[model samples]
Target chain A: MLEMSQVSYQVGEKWLLDSISLCIQPGEMLALLGQNGAGKSTLLKVLSGECRPASGAVTLSGQTLQTLSTNRLAKQRAVLPQKSRLNFPFKVLQVAMMGRSPYRGERYQASAEVVYDALKATGTAHLSERVFTTLSGGEQQRVHLARVLAQIWSPSEDNQARYLLLDEPTSALDLIHQHSVLEVARKFAREAHVGVLAILHDLNLAAYYADRVAILRNGKMLCQGEPFHVLTPATIYQAFGAIVKVMRHPERERSPLVVWTDQTESQSIKTGKRSVSQGINKSA
Target chain B: MLTSIQMHNSPGGTSCEAMREITATHRSENVDAASSVAHVVSSRRWSFGIGLFVLLVVVAVAALGVGAVSISPGEIISILVDSLGFPLAGPLDSAYQQIITSIRFPRVALAVLVGAGLAISGAAMQGLFRNPLADPALIGISSGAALAAVAVIVLGATLLSGYTAFWGIYALPVAAFLGGLVTTFLVYQFSNFNGRTSVSTMLLAGIAINALTIAVTGLLTYMANDEQLRTLTFWSMGSLGGASWDELRVAAPILLLSIVLIPLQASALNALLLGESEALHLGYNLERVKRGLIVLVALCVGVSVSFTGIIGFIGLITPHLLRLSIGPDHRFLLPFSALLGASLLLASDLLARTFVSPAELPIGIITSLVGGPFFLWLLLRQRRRGESW
Candidate 1:
């Protein structure tokens, strides 16, 4: 289990996460939802031990994350940062091997069964030797997922549940790869029994795959529950200011689908303006 | 789930993607497998193939015919063969043979060592810095050596008299070595903040230090007497005029030691071709590598400068030419650079000797005239595309 205890993070005097606390249980997938600047990614980084929190504690099992050494924390949790910039031509297998760094005796040790399994599971097994930087966005994400999956398991200790914290994992994926990738993450939770937390911009994907949805608005937890309970019309407007209709997915009823089935109020009617003002607004 | 995969699989969809992925994989794997084979084979063969050993024999023969005596090649060989206590068919003059053995031979050997040492140091420094513009002279190492030699000449510091003074030339090289070491140490210390040395920051530090040392050298030149001025100017222009057997003895060990250190470190330099972070992940301690190389290059530069003053391009040009010809594999690059460096320096020194009859020109003048424009061309070539990473 990974627990955040009254975690408060601020950037330049503005709180990004205000006195928040939550415990992520093993064998569960949590979706973090928020608007563009809602601190979802920062909170993920804070939990990943990439950024140290100013106050309070993040505990892995019973041990405080603050007390763990860098390598120790790396072994316990794997984070897929938003993107990687590698201008040099490193191959896909080589990058996937980098995920096994915390497990190795030295720099790059011999490959283990777990890394191989991670590569196969993500369907990136065939692309193993292809140059990583040359791949398209979707292909790169698959390779990255393979890397993180490899890191999220190690034989070092069995006392703690490994955490896979991804920042926008599905943003660049196409429809089919998106499903394939999420299925891989789901397998990690159900089959591998690891704790998974991801920041998602796509609400439909979240509602489809998440065990629970945690709504963050203006850097505070607005609500946290199952998708059906938290994803309502009022909540959508309150969080995003968009008028969206919440309905059951046609194929998967338990999952909620958001339909932006309504149009906007005229700007002149609302603001009492005589003429349209910005960016060729007369067409609208 | 397996049934769903089959159902959604368009006739040309999944298999097409998989096939393309496999082909790409095969191409990359082929490259990796090829490089790994090349690496293993190269290692198993000769580790460094110190080609300078071969060049020494050639230059030694060439140097015999070079002096004002104008002895034929056969005569030089006859004189050499005549000295191993063989009874001469005709008769060998004892004094002429002595001059050949004691004077010309050691001078030639010192020339070979000096060229190989400085050029190899430049190659190693370029590899270490991963910047093509690196040279023994570029990083203030030569200036430090220059400052020390100038100090000795201006101060009239002499340990021996007359012929002993001419032969006991090891003092200048020693002074130059000490100055180069200090400057290298200062550059390393000043450029660093945390444990790691930033390459750009290090380059800037080298440039500043280089400029400062040049300014100080100019001031020293201003204060010198006419005789002192001529003496320091000759040293700065660089030469092999003072190379005695004693001087060769001192420079030999330092050059040999540098050749050993850099080529032995070819794998480390290859690892550095990747950026610092990747190198660190590959398990090479970047700080240790950087410190090790800086010290190594400094040692080589110090020793070379001691003997030859400021012989310019051998270090910078050798590695680059080797790279153009043999590619940038440091294993090949290191040894090839040393060989090509030794050969080129000998040729330049030969030209320096032959340029104005009995009045010898400094070898450094020849290298700078050739090396400077070539260096500018490389710098411009590197800057043609995007900014350097």
Candidate 2:
């Protein structure tokens, strides 16, 4: 389990993240939702040791995060940061092989079989021959997924509890791949008992997938609970300043759908001649 | 997850099983010229075998013949054989034999050693910085040595007027060595962050340090009296004019140590190409590796600068030229750069002597004149392709 108690971060003179408290249980899929400046990345960084909270602490499996050595921390918790840019023509296999970095002992060379298995698991087998830099964003994300999986490679042992932290894993993904990637993560969490914390942009996707949701507005959590409890229209309005309707997904039985308020306003606009008034009301 | 079968697709140029590239970089356009060129060029190990092999033989032969009174290569060999107490047909003249054995042999050896040292230092610095443009002089190491040499030149005889001027010549290389170390240490300090040297920062710091060293060298030059100024100028411009057996005692060891250390760093340089984080992942402790390289380069450069002043370009040009022909994998690049550097410097030194004949041109001048254009060409070519290095 990963637990953060009143974790906060200040950079320069401003607080990037204020006092935030949350707990992520093993096998749980926690979706992090926030605006552009909502400290979503900062929150993940604090948990991952890329940043330290100004006050309070994040503890993993009762061991304090601040005290764990870098290599040890890497082995236990794997983070897949968003890709900005890479300046190499690193082959896809080489890029994927880097995931095994933390596991290397004195002469650490990850076994070929282990790398092959991780590649197989992530279904990036076809891209093995492709250069990493040449791949499209979605393909790159899967490659990154393979890398992360290889980083936490376990031969047969299940005793090792793992933490997988992803920063906006599905942002650039197409709709089908989005669901496919999330389903893979969901399976990894339940079967592997890997705790997952992902920062997400799509609220409906978060509601459909996350076991629990934590919504942040301006660096502080606005609400945190089960998706059914936290996906209300009022909270969405308070967080986003836009009215939206919450309903069960028509296809997925347990999934939640958040239809925007503009849909309703446009429907009324279609019935009446005064579309300009409707646009004004919607803008307001 | 790349399947087992597909993982071997992009063949790594430098795996543990890495061997010499049999891949010919140049096109076989006009196969006869290329073939004849290859046929005459000695072997595939061009820099290691051909360049050094030919230079050694030519230097050995030329050194025997180049004194005030020339001796034929055959007569010089006879003199050497006569001196060993193995009688030759007609006994070799004593004075001519002494001049050849004592004066000329050591000077030629010193020339080779200094040339080798400067070239290897340049190549190592290039690899360490991951920039083909960096040379020994680029880091202020040469100026550091020049300052030390100038100080010893100007003040040593005046301060200890009792001592013979003979000992004063040794002061410059010694002072230069210390100065070089200090400058490299400072360069390492300014550029290091989180125990890893940032190559870009290191290059920038090298520029700043080089500027400071130039200012200091100028100050020392300004303070020198006419006689001392003359001595300092000769030292500053660089030469094999001061070559002697005694100087080789120190230069040879330092040169040998660097030659041994640099080739070992090939793998480290290869890893550095992937950037620091990835290299660390590859199990290299970057800080230690960088510190070792800096010290090695400084030591070699300091020794070379002390004796020969600063020969430019051998470090920068040799590595880059070798890379154009051999490609950038450090396994081949490092050793080839060292060999090519030595051959280039020695050949240039030979030109510096023969070009002017009686009035010798400093080897440093020749290198800079050649190096500056080559440097500009490399910059332009890289700019045309985008200078990623």
Candidate 3:
């Protein structure tokens, strides 16, 4: 479990994360949803121990984050940043193998096996020999996902649950890959009992994959809970200033569908006729 | 929860033993494809390593044969064997023995040591900066040492006339080494802002610092008397003519210590290639690694410039040429560069010695003449490929 209590991060005079409190349990996927400049990445950094919070405490499993040594912290937590660019001509497998750097004591054969498994898990096995810089944006994103997966491929020595923090992992991915990547995370969480905290842009995707949803608006937590309880139309409007419909998915009943109502406005302008805008009126 | 065999649609791969074999084959094949030139270079790095060692020894021996008093290769071997407490099968002249053992050997050894030091330092700086163009001299290390050396040569007569006779031959190099270290520290400080050392900023700052140091060196040269001017010019051109057992005694320990310690950083450098944040994520202490690299490069390059003046381009070219032939795996790159660097310098020094018979050309002149064009070609090639490194 990763727990943050009244965690606030300030940059200069402005607060990026304002007294935010949250907990993520092992075997659970917690999706962090927010608009642009909503401190999603900053909060992810703080949780991953990349950035220090101004106040409050963060604990991974049972140990305080600040007290844990770097190598020990790395063995327990893996982070995939928003934008990672590699200019050198490293092979895809070599890039994946670097994820095992923290586990320097592990034998090379064992680590290589883990790297191969990670590549297979992310459906990037075919690109193992390809140069990393030659890959497409979506392919590179998946390769990095595989890298982080390989970072925490196995549990800790004491069998403590590990943490994986991903920032906008699917922003560059295609539709199939986006779903597959999230599915990989969900499966990893379920099987390995690892805690996952992902900052996502797609509301419906988050609802589908996440065990719980935490919504942030302007560095403040608007609401958080089971997707069904927190994703009502009124809450969506209050969080994102735009009106969106909260409906049940055709296949997954528990997951809510967040449909944008902006298309009707654009149609109204095109056709010189104003639609009733039922979703907006209902939210109001 | 499906195994790799099931995912890959292999019926026989259902067994763990078969899966392990498949993965091993997969990894080797990946390595082979990535280093497409692997076979043509050598079947194994060990063979390649042995080949380079043989090439260095041959070049070093060949260098011994081509000096002012030409000695046959057999005689050279005989002299080496006789010196090593073994009876020579062939008769070796006493004059030949004295020239080979005293004059050529120390010069050749110093050439090899300086070349290896500069090249390894360049490779390490390149990895640290993540830029192919990063050379220690390009970052004002050499020029800084040059400035200090020039200052000492011009001012030592009157300002330090008291201690000049006592320090004797040691003053110039000692001043140059201190100058190089101080300048490197200054450039490091200038580039680091708010605990982040920006490579682009460091490069630009290096350029400015180089310009400033060169201008100061020029001023010192202008202020020098006629004798001091000649000394400064000869020193700046860079030569192995000053190589003696005494100077080598001082420089060899520092160089050997640095060479032994640098290759240990291969894995850390490999991780750093991913980027600083990624290195940090991999549990590397970024500040410690960065600081350690700066100090190491400073020590290596400082000692080198102090001994041989400011030899340019060996550091930049050796690692890059080696990288293009071999892959960018620093484990092989660092050691191979050391061997290749030693060979290159010895060869260049031999040519510098014999190219104009008796009128010896400075080794720096030859290296710069070759390295400047090669550097330009590399830049154009990287531009054509649209790759930064």
lDDT of 3 by residue, B1-389 (tens): 23533454344212223223323446665444434533433467768888999999999999999877889888998998999999867677999999998889899999999999899989998888777778888999998888877877888888866656777877776777777788788877887675455788888989999999988888888888888887787767888888888988888998888777888888788878877777788788777877787777778887888788788999999999987766677888888888998999998899888999789898889999999999999999998988774
Q: Would you list the clashing residue pairs of candidate 2?
A: A119-B1
- Between candidates 2 and 3, the one scoring higher on lDDT is 3
Residue A262 of model 3, lDDT score? 62
True contacts kept of 3: 0.23
Q: Write the per-residue lDDT of candidate 2 for residues B193-242, one digit (tens) a residue.
A: 75455768877888888787778778878878888788777877888877
Candidate 1 lDDT by residue in tens digits, A117-154: 56667777667667665688878887878777777654
The local distance difference test score of model 3 is 0.81
The best-first sequence of candidates by DockQ reads 3, 1, 2
| Comparison by DockQ, 1 against 3, better one | 3
Task: Give the per-residue lDDT of model 2 (tens digit) for A56-80.
Answer: 8999778888687666666667777
TM-score of chain A of each: 0.89, 0.88, 0.92
Ranking by lDDT: 3, 1, 2
The reply for model 2, stretches above 4 Å from the true place, is A1-9, A17-33, A37-251, A254-284, B1-136, B139-141, B148-209, B244-246, B249-300, B322-340, B386-389
Candidate 1 CAPRI-style tier: incorrect
Candidate topping lDDT = 3
